[model samples]
Structure formats: structure tokens, C-alpha cells
Target chain A: MLSDMQNNEFQTYGYTFKEVGLTPGEIARFLKVDPSEKEHPANVFIHEILNKLPDNKEITGGYRILPVDDLNVKEGRLACNNVELNPGRQVSTCLQKSEYIALFVCTAGDIFTGLTRRFNRRGDSLEAYITDAIGSLTVEKAMDGIQSQLEKAMKKRDLQITDRYSPGYCNWPVSEQKELFALLGETPVPVSLTGTCLMIPIKSISGVIGIGKEVRKSKYACAVCGDENCIYIKIIKK
Target chain B: MEDLLNKLHNCVEFGKTDINSPYPPDRKGQKGALEYTQELLEKGASPTNIMELALIPAMNKVGRKFSENKVFVPQMLLSAKAMNVSVHLLKPYFRTGELKRKGVFIIGTVFGDLHDIGKNLVAMMVEGAGWEVVDLGVDVKPEKFTEALRQHPGAVVGLSALLTTTMVNMKPVVDAIKAESPATKIIVGGAPLSSGYAFSIGADGYGKNPQENVLWLNAIGYAK
Candidate 1:
């Protein structure tokens, strides 16, 4: 189901609704509809919004792996292929034994953003909210796709990998996004940072995955943060 | 005339904008809030009666449902839009002091936060509640909020931040506003904020969502 989504492309972005793995419950949560009210107008409206969405398009991602040279765990600093990084405590602990790090950027593209703006302009906030939620889910699926590709490439070399860690996650400051973008050279996804370090398209994400034998993959890390409204927390609870 | 007022109320409640709007499928081809409001005014309905009897009551229901989580942002926004259609028709009366707004509401996204969806939602909801809203837009500094308070005395203030990092900026803005006008009622909200955090930063109240903000404003005597 996931690989088939990668085959679907629109303009510069490859996407598929199937890859997004969106469920009625998830959509309902984003729409703030009661979970039991399956026939609510908001639910119907969400369905219409989903149907209006471009089927063959969702998200795109780009990534590159670089060897890590010098590492100072005490100072929580890392040097990977001449790119100095202060990944902070959380990322440092995750990447301590990594021989290489996969740097990646993923974006849900401009279609959803444009549609959201259009809906907002037309006074159809329901459509805008539903579309924006879908866009967020798309970016996550794109990141998952990138991780899977990286795992596939590493399998041939008999290398295991760690869980992905992103800037603004754990102790890594969001400012690190600039360095990640710089290291990627020419990003496959058209993700750009705003003056305040927010990614453009608003649904883009950047992260690094450590590659090595001793690196452990964390299945759920919602415990690291205490945000009750986090989607990850909701998913984990489910 | 009473029937027309009820029609206008139901139109706003159901987010029916006009006869052509297809939303709330049941009301698809009916004359919506837009048409009913215009017709009522044309047929000698006072702006004050229309607003007090229909628009405000419909928005109040919308606000209450929103606070109870029975209605979400989109539904509330649609209702706000429906109410705005009638409010637009009443603007002339407001200019002549014939129709008084509930109160002024000054809102903005705190500095370093470019996110405005939450702020915009609050602005629309407050405006729907019959208050005059002055949106300072995104990335507003402490001075900007204080300056706005100076211009619109006794106006309530709201600060929003989507990021945890940026949410910290609300402290300084709240402090600045309090320093300038101690009587001002300040409310804060965003994804990363809790009531505890808001209280810690000297905010008078914290709304978990837009509807709660309106309720808080009402509780604090900002109601019409």
C-alpha cells in the first residue's frame, strides 16, 4: 500500500492518500467531531473535503547520509562530514554510537496549503481545517517513506538504524533546521525556512536518523514530551 | 417579522450564507442569513433588534456548542461568517452610535510565532459574539499590544502561540500590557499552553479554544 503511493506523482511531488493512512477516527479528531457521531455534518463535510483532494498527490521527501567524524557527547555536539551540529541531549543520546546520520526533509507540498487558503477565503473553514489536517498527515507519511527507503539501502550493508529525531523534538533547538537544510545541499522537496525558522508549506519536517549496530529504535517517544494534545500521544493510546 | 428573525437565527446557526450556498445540505436552497438579514432590514427591522434578537443569540449558541466541543473550529467559523454577513449590514448603524458593540477585543500571535490560525479563529469567534475585534496580526510584540490597549481602553486582549518556544514570548507581552493598563483582562491560548502556564505568566484567563475565550470574556463582564 505504501510503495504504491510512492508511484503516484503530481508535478514535483509523489503522493497517495493510501500512504497517508488516514482513518475516520483521525479525521474526526482533527475536525473535533465526537468520535461516536459518525454521521455528523462535520464528518460528511470532511468526506467531501477528502474527495475534493487530489488523489494522486500528497507529499515528497529527500535525504542524504553522511559519515560522522568527531563527536563530543559531553558538550552534546557532533561533526558529520564537516557539518557541525549541536543536537542537544535528546538527539545526542539517540545518535551517540552512530557511524553515519541520515539527514532528510519532507513536505506535503503547496496544493493542500493553497486549498486551505482558498477554503478560508471562501468562508468554508471546515474544508480548510480538514485539508490542513490531511496535509500534516501527508508529511508524516512522507517521512515514513524516507525512513523505509533508508532502511532498505542499509539492509544490503548489514547496518541497523536508530529512530528518527527532528529539530524541535527533545532538546534539539529548531534553529538546527538551517544546518540540516545546508547539509542536504539541494533538497528534493521544496522546503524552506522562514525568518523565525518555521518551515514553509507549514507541513514540512526535517530530521536525522542514526545508522549503526548499537543504535536503538524507539517505537514511541511521546513520553519525552507532556503535550496531551499531541497526535503521537493519541496514536499511542489507540 | 418574528418568523424572519427566527429564520435569520437558524441560518446563522446552521452556517447557511445565502440561497445558493450548499452547506448544511438540508438548507441548501433556502434564503440564508445573508438574504434574511437584508430582507429584515429592508422591511423595517431595526439593526439593534436584529443583532440583539437574532445574530447575538445564534452566535451565543455557536459559542456554547463550541465550548462543549459539540462544534469545532470549522463549524464555529462558518457561523461567524454567517453572522458577519448580517454584521456587515449593521455597520452603518454602528458608525452612528445607534448600535453599540459589546466591547473591543485586541488579539495577536505573540512575537516569534508566525502561526495565526488559532488567533484568527478567536478573532472571528469574538467578532461573532458582537465585539469589535482589532487583530494585530502575527508576530506581535509586547509594545504593539500595549499600544493597542492604550488606543482602545478597557478592551480585552488575547495572545496566541503555536510553538512551545514562542509561547514563552507571551509572558513579556502580558506583563507589558498589565504594566500599561492594570485593568485590562488578558487571555492566552495555543497548542502548547495550559491554564497553569497562562496563570504563571500573569494572564487573567486562559482559553483552551476560541469558544472558551468568548465565555471568559463574557464572565469578566465584557458581555453586551
Candidate 2:
């Protein structure tokens, strides 16, 4: 329902740090530390990292919406218009009500990657870890801003949206990033996927959200995922 | 000498690196692993005894505690740091054949996978376990792994990939290593891997954690 978006309209956004608005409580939660334990090494380390993530470094994201015409539950095949993607069973089920699919890629710039690499090279393991965690948080925070903007646009037309899902997470194999990137059609999403399926910025995220009048956002269900090694499991548990 | 070695073991186990290290706050400002190691050598204690009585036991204890979640990554890294400085004191003995490492471990992140934190952690953990580690860095090609195998014939290989996409690349690398070095053992690990995936990819072992990998190597009689 966004005025600028049609059946497959690509839209790119640049977000300021104020828009992303990372908080100390969220950073502490991500690092599995208590905010009150400010002197704890991890907490102390995160403070230094947060101060280094300059607000001037703007985050970026791009998204395109495509109409979904087919869904093969058995194979988790999703045929949106002409682009066919098999993102796996769980994803297909969650997206059953979708009239459109929003393919999105967001990144937290490149500074954190360099910071993490520097600490790692210096053998400062704890510093490197906290920096990496902050980078992860920053990218997701950027994505949250983008998603909120889309939601506000949808509200004008009384449209609803399902929760966003990424290829590497849940039951969808990370290899599907190849297909997802191809669907973006080189429209300059600003994030690149390597041959090995990793996003280039190192602090980047790519995924899809379902949009329709009847579609609804649901709480994340970790029980349906088969990946036992996911770090999110620990986050959710804690 | 035995008492000094015991003190050094405690230092390494508790993650006290040097007199200046403020970790294990109760032991703050006290002489640490490096200091104890130097003092023991000045007293004419055998470097081999320092390794056997102090470093190995201390690292094994840390590794065990980590596997049990009694300690976490930061604590484990701290212990490894203490062990590294102490081990540095015995480098000359190793060069002079007065001491011997358990064996060699050649490790790298699989090709196309740029992530190296997991690989580095494993490499450091193996090094602390007394292996001479050859870290090939990240984005390593299959040929590079086999070539390293050629140079260190009896060395075990460790493959790491932090993404599911890169995890798929492990199968081919395992195949290439098996083709060239039939007797070589390959251990695969990363965030997205399970023992099932490792077995399916033809890896000889799956290191669920760094401690598990160390235990596997120690159990295999790699220390000669």
C-alpha cells in the first residue's frame, strides 16, 4: 500500500543512528549480562565498543515487494510472480497468508567489522566478542527501523504483515541466500552474498516479510526450528 | 620444585597470566604463570616436568570446566593466555629437543567463509593443549588444506565454517583431503554444524566444542 511501491517496486532507505537508537539494556541482554553489573568486564568492554560506534555512520537497507501466486508446502516452494524460491517448510507455513513477499537486505556499515578484526588480531578476545555482539545488535536495530517504516505505510491501507524471516535462520538453509540474492535482480541492495552464502558486510542481515490484509505478525517460534546450534536459542532461553 | 610447579598449575588454571594480571581478583598483584614458570626454570626444574606437571593439567582442567559450562569463553581465553605465556618460556627446550609437543594441528576456515573467530578459538585451545598449531587463517581453499597436510604428514586437520552455506563447502574439502591423504584425520566444526553433518561430510571427527576436540586428540594417543 506504500505509494511508491507497486507489484515489484524496489525501495532503498538510509537510517541514522538516532533512528536505530540502540540502548544499553538491549546490548546487555544480547551479551547475557545484567545492566547493573556495569563493572563486569563484558559490560565494561561493551561500553567502550558502543562509544566507538559513531552515530555519523549511517546504516542502509533496501526492499522489494513481489506478489506471491503459489506455495508448495511439501517442498516449501514459494513462487512469487515468476521468481521461484524454496525457502523450506517452516517458512512456507508461516508465510501461508501472504499476498506479497518483501525481500530485504540491511547492513550496519563496515566499521564494526574492522574493529572486531583489529581486536581479534591483537588477541583481545573479550573486546572482539563484545564488538561483534554490538555489530549484530546494530544491524538488527537498523532492520527494525526499516520494518517499522514499512508497517506505518501499510497502516494507511489497513494491510497487515507477517514477521520477517531470513534464509539462514529457522529451517531455511543458508544456501537459499543465493536464490534470494538472485531475486533482488542486482537492484543495488548494498549487501552482497559470497559464493559460500555469507553476506559481505559481516554485520549485515537479509530476509523477507509477508504482506497482506489478512497476514499477521506472530511471536517467533523457536520450537519449530531444527538448528540446535543457533545462538538465538541461548538468547531466547536467557 | 614440585610445590613451585603446583603453584604454576594453579596460576594457569585460575587464569593468572603475570604479576600484573588483575583477573581472578583474589590473586591480584601476586606472581602468575609466567613468573612462576621463569622461577621454576631458574631453579633447574625440567621443562618437560613444567609441561607435564603444570601446563597440560591446567589446560585440561580449564577445558573440562568449559565443557561443563562452569566457565565461559572469556574465562577459557584467559586461561589459554596464561598457558601461552608459560609455554613461551619452554620454546627453547622444544627447539633443543628437551621437550616435545603432543603433535601438529593444521586448522583453517573453509574456502569462501571469511569468519575466523571460531577457528581462532579452536586453534588457541589446541595450542594450549600442547599441540604446535599451524593456523592457515580464513577463506582457505581445498588445495591449501591438502598442501599443508603434505608438509605436516601426520598432522590432524581441523575445518571450520560459521555459516550453513560455507558448511556445505566442507564436504568437498573433506573429500579432497581424503583423496590426497587417505590416512589423515579431518575434524570439522563451526556454529552451524552437528556431528551428523560432520559424519556425512566424511570428517573423522566433529568437535562440538574446543574441549571436545582437545579430548579427542588426547584420547587418540597423538602425544608421542
Highest TM-score scorer: 2
Error of 1 at B172 (Å): 3.4
Candidate 1 lDDT tens digits, B66-110:
777677676787787788878988999999999988889999999
lDDT of 2 at A103: 89
Query: Model 2 segments beyond 4 Å from truth?
Result: A1-4, A16-19, A33-39, A223-228, B222-224
DockQ of 2: 0.51
Tens digits of lDDT, candidate 2, A119-176: 8888787778777777787788788878988888777878887878888777788888
Which candidate comes out best when scored by lDDT? Answer: 2
Interface RMSD of each: 3.9, 2.4
For residues B58-125, write the lDDT of model 2, one tens digit per residue: 98899898788787666677788889889888999999999988889999999989888778878888
Error of 1 at A179 (Å): 6.9
